[model samples]
Target: MSVIRTAILGYGRSGSTLHAGPIEKNKSFHVTAVCDVDATARQKAVARFGCRPYDDYRRMLKEEPLDLVVIVTRSDQHCQMTCDCLAGGVNVLVTKPWAVNAGEAQRMVSTAKSSGKLLLPWLPARWGSDLQRLRQLVVEEQAIGTVFLVRRVEGSFATRNDWQTERRYGGGYLLNWGPHIVDPPIQLLGSPVKSVYGRLKQTINPGDVEDLFMGILTLANGILVQVEYTVSTESPPTWFLQGTRGTIVVHGTQLKMNARTPAQPSDPTQYSTMQAVPDKMLEEKLAGSLYGDEHQIYKEIAAALCGETRYPVTPASALELSRVLDAIRTSSNENRVVMM
Candidate 1:
């Protein structure tokens, strides 16, 4: 398709702001229709994008001749809606935490395969410049030597009383920000996870679910990754990486690094006299902004649809992330480490 005809299945915050905005900005895509349960939202979509709007997704699927459907609905509805779109002979791009669990994610993947349609998870963070720089420094350049520990902390003193705080709706920190936070460290580690230990706590959020969560992942190479999020306190560093020969701390748009090359003393008794040393101290700017460029993902998607290139986030990789999510939730609920 020269210009992919796209329809948005949800016209809420994520649908309008995150999905529709970038898609409309891309030259390879055109917003043809929108579906939302709310009549007001449907009207808003029609006015904003000058497109046909429907109150039901099934009706939109049946009526619109769309080449792609962007499913931006609630977490629990992602799997079925994706399957419906794929079965309707349209490619699908669903929002993060694509499904409630691994089983649902697998079902969506299977349906897409059976229908011979493209399935993509909305993981735009994979294209972030900060992550690109991290990969270049940590993996490609080995600037930090052998990475032994990685920590990602994201949170602030705040509270949410929305539907997101409700567990019945697949609402919690694990499914909320977890996909974005969890995938990066794992991707940087470049190794299969051996085990996961997780913990969940309800601090300030007015819901039955947790607002604070932590996950400790042990990778196959013995690298340890720790991710902690909360709504009750001030946030620490966005990223901290500790390696055998150096340490990196992400301070806003720059990386502050301290590194040294160790030279063993000729005498065994000189161990205590070793100088407190970091031979090098450096500050490097990130490759680009940590956020923005939602359109890049849409461009890639359009190219993938046209058979020009491969999509970075594949169905198989998404399925693996779903399984990792399952393990984290199970570990938290059972209060024990879950081995992968």
Candidate 2:
């Protein structure tokens, strides 16, 4: 297959670690160009990949043609960058927390549609074996029974006081990390959120954004997905599904099955967090168990762009998830349930 020459708009952590690494490794795409206002980042991308670098994406797009542009900048920059890229007749793949609000996301979709360009904020975890296969089992196999409740928790050590503390730049835990933890429930429940009651706390860390958040979502499926987020937490994290038959618990990066058939000591580690860390030596065996599932995410995006698949994050789904976040903020303010 011929390579898809790509341009990356930002050389931040997402660009360097997430997008650059995979795109560099894959044969289907080659990162031909990069742009970053940060001199160090630009020099690194230029030197490391032997590609052209620019301080402004506008100038870069004007000078060099690219098939795709990866927007790995701050969340606040997504709408304009996407608009500019699409208007310049280039496709875009963006980092998640699609937009700071629903209106911007809708506008992005509309602009892309008008320009005949594709814009996707693909959350990679939804394609994992643990998530995808579990989605199949839940709806297909009726595994984990009825699934009365779904709970997702993302806890990390924020003691270092990273930048996710401000309200501007979409600097909050919700925008920084919520999309990955929340996508699975939306996929499994197959429901539109009808109402939301939520709460947030900032017990350990002091900042404009809440270090902890909890939201109760009443869905059209008659199931509830309770989302909890905390960066100040010290406990081991879990993403759990409870049902009539049994339960499925995703602890850290391990998956445990409890059902009528029960489980042996082994069943392949299909937990979603396996590929997040770049430790080649620590868990090679478990990583190998999840071989084909590695970049099911990029495959989903590539398929959609190649016209073989649809946008994985639909407009309504994006709106629903945004409403959930909105409700979390509203409920934190009004101290009441918010209608969707």
Candidate 3:
């Protein structure tokens, strides 16, 4: 098998640590070059990876022979950079928010389709251990019968004066932490969102954009998923799964579950307002690490590049996420539920 030569754009934030670190750990990928405008970051990249560094991304694209380009720049730059890379005959693995809106995401997707290049979104949450376990229980084993509601809550009491708090730079909790928070429930629900009702506020951040948001997604299967990402003082359970027979809650690394036995009606005419029937309710406590295999996504990317298999995260799915995000914004702005 031949190693896939790769280049990275942006080194300050996720470019080096998130993109380069994983690529370097995977044997199928080779970091051929790195592009960053920061002189110090470029020097650090050379020292760490021993790869040539360029200040200009286009110059690096022109000079280097690369199979893949990982774009980890500001959210606003994702669309254009991805299109440029696809046009240059290199597959793109861009981090979310892949685009600020669904229209931009469509352009990126269309460009990749026209160029015959792979466009993958960096959605690591799909491979998270908690979600994988949930899938096994809810979908395969039917441990939790008929999932109806799923909730993901993540946030802290804090304020940042960084670029992330500003709208012009494509910075907000909605774009920053929203993708990771939203992907798992969507995958588990296995349905396209039918409508979105969202509320965004600028609570503590100094930016013009909202620092926190509460987004309610009603899926096609009628499963309701609520996502609350805030910078406020309240910290809730990380995850909540409610089904017909059971409920699951995750607090830190611990998962607690309670499954009630199915109650059978003995008589056709007897309708009791309340009756306690004990059929031995199942209770479980799962305690341990709640992290997925870190390099699984990179391994899959290598396989996809080798034509051995298709990348699991499809362009259409990523675009759907973008569309959901767009609807959330619309709902928040207009103060009404937006239909898909």
Candidate 4:
């Protein structure tokens, strides 16, 4: 099997740690070049990977014979860089959220289709161990017995002074951390996000962009998934799954479940409100890790490049995520619920 020559655009934290590190580890991918405007970062890339480093991505594209270009730049730069790479006959893998907005995402998708190049979103959360285990339990084993509600919360006390805190750079919890947290629910619930109600605010963060947000997404399947994030919280449940017969709560790496025995009868007349039935609850505790599957991302990209399998992050799904994000922004701005 021939190795896929790859180039990384942007040698910052994401480009270095997430993209370059994983590609270097995977045998199927070869890092041939990296593009960054920073001379220090370029020098580090050259020393670390012994690959060509260009200050201009366009020049890199013109010079290198690359099979894939991973765009790990700012969110605002994602669309243009991706389109440019596809137009240059290089397949593209962009980090999420795919673009700054839905319109840009659609344009990127259209460009990729016209260019006949594979465009994949680097959504490593799809292969998260905690989510994988949750899927096995909730979807396969029915351990939660018809899940009705799912909540994902990420909280930290942080004051970041970087591009990530700037609005012009597409810096906000909704865009930076939103894609990862939102993808799993959308994947599980399936689409036609009936409506979205959200609130965005900035507190204890020195930025115009919001540092905290509470978004309630009502899926067509009657599942209510709440996506919440805050950079100023002390403690919050990382994951919460509630069903008719049981509930699962994940804190840190620990999973605690409480499920009641004897499925509740469907007939309302079977039980009286005044009389209490004996409670038979089963409890369980499991430990797991929540880490992005960067290796899996590389594997999928390699397979897609090799024509062995289709890339999992479809354009439609990515567009849907963008749309949902747009709606959330609108909802927060207008102070009203937005319908999908």
* Predicted model with the maximum lDDT: 1
Clashing pairs in 2: none
lDDT of 1 at 286: 79
lDDT of 4 by residue, 250-339 (tens): 776677777655445678787744332334344344433365567777888899999999988788888889998888889999999999
Which model is ahead, 2 or 3, in terms of lDDT?
Answer: 3
TM-score of each: 0.96, 0.84, 0.93, 0.92
Name the TM-score of candidate 4: 0.92
Clash number for candidate 1:
0
User: Candidate 3 — number of clashing residue pairs?
Assistant: 0
lDDT of 2 by residue, 99-156 (tens): 8876788788788889988777656666655566567657888866688888888787
List candidate 4 stretches off by more than 4 Å.
261-289
Cα-based lDDT for every prediction: 0.86, 0.74, 0.85, 0.84
Query: Model 3's lDDT to the true fold?
Result: 0.85
Per-residue lDDT of 49-155 in model 3, one digit per residue for the tens? 88999999888889999999999999988999999999999999998789988999999999999999999888887777778777877789777679899999888
Q: Cα RMSD to native, each candidate?
A: 1.5, 8.9, 2.2, 2.5
Q: List the residue pairs that clash in candidate 3.
A: none
Task: Give the Å error, residue 256, model 3.
Answer: 1.3
